[model samples]
Target chain A: MENVILRDVGLRDGLQLVKAIVPTEHKIEWCRRVVAAGVPEVEITSLVPAKIAPQFADAEEVVAATLSIPGYLPSALIPNARGAERGFALGIPKLNYVLSASEEHNLANIRRSTQASIDDFGRIVELRNETAPKTCLAAGIATAFGCTIQGEVPEARVYEIAAELCGLGADEIIVADTVGYANPAQVKRILTGVMKEIGDRPLLLHLHDTRGLGLANMAAALEVGVRAFDASIGGLGGCPFAPGASGNINLEDAAFLAEATGFATGIDIEALVALRQTVETWLPGERFAGQVAQSGLPKTFAPIHRQAA
Target chain B: MENVILRDVGLRDGLQLVKAIVPTEHKIEWCRRVVAAGVPEVEITSLVPAKIAPQFADAEEVVAATLSIPGYLPSALIPNARGAERGFALGIPKLNYVLSASEEHNLANIRRSTQASIDDFGRIVELRNETAPKTCLAAGIATAFGCTIQGEVPEARVYEIAAELCGLGADEIIVADTVGYANPAQVKRILTGVMKEIGDRPLLLHLHDTRGLGLANMAAALEVGVRAFDASIGGLGGCPFAPGASGNINLEDAAFLAEATGFATGIDIEALVALRQTVETWLPGERFAGQVAQSGLPKTFAPIHRQAA
Candidate 1:
């Protein structure tokens, strides 16, 4: 867990939520700061039709900027094989292939059924192998906990899809609670079973605080040996897939939790709070999320664990 | 758990964080609104020195006003036996007792050692038995998780103090993550052990999202069958006890999580959100917390568990 990598997705996921369109160059600058921070990985942009998400119109440019930053793992989201192809062509570090587990969510979010999306995932895997062998392919099964279109996603279905994603040659399999309905016990229960089937695929926990269980679910996953987590800087990206849900785990809060406890994720809390100042200036209309950043550290704060030892 | 009482400490615990003194009448009016919203229990005020917290200088008067509200189980903080006497005379339904678990925290917060505080608890218990027989007494083992002053508070000591409190005739024990240093696993491990020693005395979880594990802790406590919780509206209070930590668990977020995870806390999410508007007008500078308040409910948001039974 000490080696866990927290990828800051504020540039892509954070920017995606703003109603006001950020300039492509400003988006590039967002990528620059995150890359400069030397976070092990970053989801720099989400590739979609420009009209739906104007904030991410310059996905190509954002990926290109990330490509320029060495030692930073640049990644982007692709909705289909086309998005996957575009991402692979960039010579970036990773491509996140996302699909909603609920059939209702897939139809509403991507205008495809669950199986259709799974079929497309096969193309994505093939695209990665043919076009970008070095580019890591991670499948994010969104709404793994439950969905807005269809509530209470079965644990067996999530486990089955994870196994299939692994069989399809996914470099990593991420179990996401898109609507944030998972409790820690439920997270522990599901992940305990899911890990058995997924074997050794680097399982990622993509959690939302939609129902205030983001960090709890993450903790349960960590207890079961999950070290890879996907979070948004300033808890940006309320939701591209679900309307009323989008804020990922706030990077600063997660860092504080991880560092305060016995785990290590090399996130500087004060620096992360500083990063939110930039985000505040960029996304003025959008309300930033997190408690530690707002309330500040405890007066008698003791950092029991060392970082990057 | 649906029948379990949730005590809102927004007025007493929440308001002290903001330095700006809200007018006494306005604070009183908000207390009325809180009670009208169907909250069964509320920690309306604390009997600390007025000089230290002028915001709560009217705690006695506030308790008087709170007791007037029909069916309100009004509670107040008494640092020692004297504060309990004041609350007892007022005929309030509950008297909350506090003693810090960390030796340094006890000194800094209440100017007492662990043994001395325990001795005081015995005296307070005796006083309650002699005078305030009608008042429900709850002893809070503050900083049971960890402390800013002494750092890691031992689990054995926490369990011992909980048993001691129960033996001293405390009606219920409040386990607080004062510094927000507790994670989900720790919350579960500690609360489970404490419950065993204390028999059936109800355990109330008082959490702060300071380090973003408050809700995570709640989920863990839920696993251990400790149903009741303490939250403040807009996550009020800035660790006046510990200093520089996050506020209490925002009531709206806690209610949202409780309902989302198939548990009913009997809080109206929309009503809770509406309640924050009143606070915004009063304490504008104070950073009130909660994510669900901003995001609203998921489109697929259905309280299936709440409806089924």
Candidate 2:
């Protein structure tokens, strides 16, 4: 059976929009529980300053706590060169850097032009090589599908940016439907092109459920042979820059989709749902989305590994 | 551009689970508004006895009211030969008949064995031939993916049922994921096989959003060349027999997905969202689903027809 990697980004992305700060201990526990549920990777925190997103104030504590969990690939989202330097100082195993394909969104999100962000990404790669050669750099193209501020982001621009990032020695390329404006056909069309440009490098899709096509988009990517995704538990997290958008595709639901469609995720869905419930209690009044948590797993469901056995 | 027919099943399937009976005048207005929004067909009501489903008590009135709308195809669900006779007597344009592929689900839902329902469907076809030759008979195989009561519904069994229904003179065949147990892979596999069996006959997919794979499953069907679907306004219905299932795919969202993916649905999404707001007020305290309603249409969104122009 083919295997897919689902990286839980709930701690960083999910908590970004919330008003209350989730305790650092709870964030660490969240990491521990999800890894126990067989998620191979977790984006434990973002490397931005507390003034920008106060919810991520305890990034160091959260990242440090995650390192103790054996066999877990802990990662952090680093927005700029300064953030990358901070992540490098902590010896983070993986650092995710994002630049929007929409120039308007890039400027709004990080106060930098798309070209400037691309140049900064190259500098971050150099910094990683010099200070922390072991750290992995994943360059994410945000608003790669479409943009709220600037409508109709051209698909050709996405391919060009992906090729440029690959040339800059990035370890991985992540295409994000940052505002959830993608359809399955667009996903198939764009991801197929991006894959061609970044030959042999790992490709991951960071999708949002804004318009209810998240899983459909993921399914389309799967058909094009994308086996890595970034999801959040309970479908937490939305882009602060994109108004009226929902959160990432629910991690439990994404895992369920992978297993149901003949791909192995190695995730225990029940455990994820249980973790979601705990998280819900921890942050009361926050909106949570996903179906498996409400209906529970179908009686016919079985993990891909078990089905093969 | 590829064209898809989105049949609004909101009046029949969407209202099936509601405890409060919606007035007949409101139902007529719903028919008028949705047709004005460019939906080609609608399942206006079910012909079951009023005592069993008080929500559909005014089936004849609803069906009659829908027929006056220009270019609109009005249909009703006919559970048995008696229901078909009621539909035939009213001169309904189309009648949808369903039998579960899972015997347990068929027994629980319609209180008949699967074979008994099949025999009854054959009788309904003969009745339509004799009494109402112009009326279309659509045979739907429910629980074609999996069953809540009986897990692991075999794919071979579904193909057999579709072929049998086709042989029995079914004018159209519909494959329903009654409990939302379908993944995109299963949808592609099953719909592909069913399409082969019912060559050149019109096929429709009846999908549910019970597990958040509704749109994803629909995308897979679209890839397999199945262009027709059954969706509900605001996702208002669920199977009374399937305990934890949510509702059918939202009509507005389904239309948006079709338009976004280069398939012409001819639906004005703004109009549907407006109607959804009115419907939500009508049925106070009912759970409504779909992201398009919550987030509104994206700035990049364009109807397929407009995009072509």
Candidate 3:
């Protein structure tokens, strides 16, 4: 409970941009290997319409298969009440809901106004309460740090949004570096203010490795007491600026840093690396980023695993 | 002087790994931009014979052209006495001499024995004393942390080699993560011991981002009074592991960090980014690595360029 809970997002964020959609069977197996290697939670897919996110058409199937494992929570990204309702029917315990802070970004990204998104969030909470009472709703503020379209999201605006989301009965507030435009100072300043305004809710950080500050930002967050992190196995996410130059922060490498810094992540980095090799070879031509995965853990590294049990 | 002088190694280290050799004129212009951006020093080329490093056949011409720029110390990597003599005679004031620490790497990489390398270093020092008395020699111990051929180089061995180079009259000692196998803990452990043995002589840490630990290791070194670093312009150095894994710490980004942390780095990042555009057009095939180069600095980050004189 004192340590961080890392959520592997490769299956969800990593496959979003790829030309080849990984088969459901292979993805299920990939999930199994990473979980076996000691990853406690995973974001398996976004609940987008199959027409748009063909890679995640099998999101329901993955959730059903992954739920059978003990000590593992399979999370899915949902945009509206409908996706939240669909995810609840499929029985995912956690729903990672997202909204954009900028009015310009919200309309461009989700085809809804920021005010309209707030309205939709209120209904999604209502749907959650009626459909599945126990399902935890972790609301993510995507591009809360900045936006490519509008640029430079003010900290006050982010704080205002987080307060509104909390008022909407959201249980968890996660700040995301959606476009990878955040520096560590920006992350610290925003997270500091947001946590102060939101007050004691589960504050999670979802950072992108855009501009290569993913890990550095995580380190800043770690110093300030934010423990839950969102990362992809082998850093598989792509850059909206380009295709995949904006890789997701690699989960195995993140685990290595957490453990290295005397923070317990309950992850075996070598096992994660082994799991990543299968993922890499299984899906050729998919861009993979992470230093520890490329060069195995240093011979001197010692991990403390199984203590969490 | 307190800020680390990170020499941009792309022209030599980055270009060496690529199959195509960049033209001499473009390289000279690149050097001009580097000097113009207030990069006080640079590793322009490795002084290996034209047969070995034909890509740097223009080393003489490059350094000679760089000498025309005032207040910039252009350095060369001298493998043997002949390379050292060549660099010294060209009037490039500073020379960085290197040899692999691991016996296997020395044999495989340079085709010389470790003990024989020590003997050659002694001769090179003698030659420098007679031929060019004012030359600054920085000794780099390659594979000092680990080796690709023989994994897990002992910390004791790294300390011993770093000590021997200083004893053999080498001006400065460089502890390099040549194989990209160093962790921050390892960097701290080895460098602390090396600093204790080789007192007050500046130790330059040449790190690779292969495992994304390049910046992490730099942070660790900063805690231990290390102020001199070796970095490339675009994180352009190739991963000895292969092509496409371009893994050098980008100098412009590193300068941003130094200035961000309130340390004094005599570099203008805006000018450096402008210089980096020169490479993007020249080497379209090259995979350049740098975060600040892609994402412009936050409007708030105003770096200290120089004293108000």
Interface CA RMSD of each prediction in angstroms: 3.1, 0.8, 4.2
- Of 1 and 3, the candidate ahead on DockQ is 1
Give candidate 2's error at residue B309 in angstroms. Answer: 18
Predicted candidate 1 versus true structure: per-residue lDDT over A1-309, tens digit per residue: 367778887776677667788877777776667656546778888877788888777777767666787766778888899888777777767888888888888888889888888888988888788878888888888888777768778788888888888888888888878777676657778888878988888888888876666887777777777787888778876666676775888887787666655666655567777777876887678867777787676553544433553
| Candidate closer to the true structure by lDDT (higher is better), 2 or 3 | 2
Number of the predicted model whose DockQ against the real structure is largest: 2
Q: How should the candidates be ordered by DockQ, best one leading? A: 2, 1, 3
In terms of lDDT, the poorest run of 10 residues in model 3 chain A is A238-247
Which model scores highest in lDDT? 2
| Winner by TM-score between candidate 2 and candidate 1 | 2
lDDT of 1 by residue, B192-263 (tens): 999998898878888877777788778678767888888888888767667667788888777766766667
Candidate 3 positional error at B49, Å: 3.4
* lDDT tens digits by residue: candidate 3, A4-95: 88889888878877778888988898888778877888887789888877888888788878778776778888978889988899888899
Best by TM-score: 2
lDDT (Cα atoms) of all candidates against the true structure: 0.77, 0.91, 0.78
- The DockQ-based CAPRI class assigned to model 3 is acceptable
